[model samples]
Target: EFLFSSLVETSTAAELAEKLRADVSPYWAVHYRFGKSAANLSATALAASSLDALLINVAAPLRYAYLRQQGTEDYRERSIEFLCGIKPENNRLVRAFGKSLQPVDASESQALIQLYREYCERRKCFFCRWGYRFLSLSAR
Candidate 1:
């Protein structure tokens, strides 16, 4: 059982991600952000992978190592897998923000906040539904 589990764990998720990159690597491009990875899918061009075992927490949204790679205008409706953290919290904020959150489609619903409020100020002004409502008003 140990050997089997080890074999399964050996396959990193990045390998599948790399394969996804190869099929559409050279022809694609991203427009915003500051540096190289900001415009490219990632470093190392991805690596080979196979999945023999999987582990997940279905109760929470997923996370990605390079979370900033997720952009608003890229796709219309999508859900992310293989992401590594707390995503449902983001989803809650977006839901409260309504349309001012533009690119309000399902694809980008679980994005983390770009700017965070001060910890001393209380998460009330930071992570609350009211905060999202406030941001939505200004974004318009």
Candidate 2:
């Protein structure tokens, strides 16, 4: 948390964020929207789980299921390579969680990819209440 505060208060958040991402790692302190996870990602408990992508799916919470980490077979799905647009006020996840951006395992990215693969095979997302909520809403 202190790391983020110092970065924010330094008037150089953008610079630091870029530096971190250049390493091909998501910033642990933000709420980035990589895509969405196929498994449950809304409980807050799993919000920062090692297998959890730092990104959140606001428009479609079930989009969480669609998010991919760097090492996942579908990791390419989560790549923000083609993004270009007028972003919303809170596009990145960092602003949402920086205040308590605890230190995550440096190995989180790999672990998350594995978990995502397992989650996909089981197709347990259909059982996720949050997933059901997103699915139901899409029909409307």
RMSD of each: 16.1, 19.1
C-alpha lDDT (0 to 100) for residue 43 of candidate 1:
35
Candidate 1 structure quality by residue, lDDT tens digits, 63-125: 221223455332222124333311223334445545666433223343423223232135555
Clashing pairs in 1: 63-83, 63-84
Instruction: Give the whole-model CA lDDT for all candidates, comma-separated.
Output: 0.35, 0.32
**In model 1, which regions exceed 4 Å deviation?**
1-93, 102-108, 112-140
In angstroms, the error of model 1 at 76 is: 23
Leading candidate by lDDT: 1
Every model's TM-score = 0.21, 0.19
The ten-residue window of minimal lDDT in model 1 covers 50-59
* lDDT value, residue 86 of candidate 1: 15
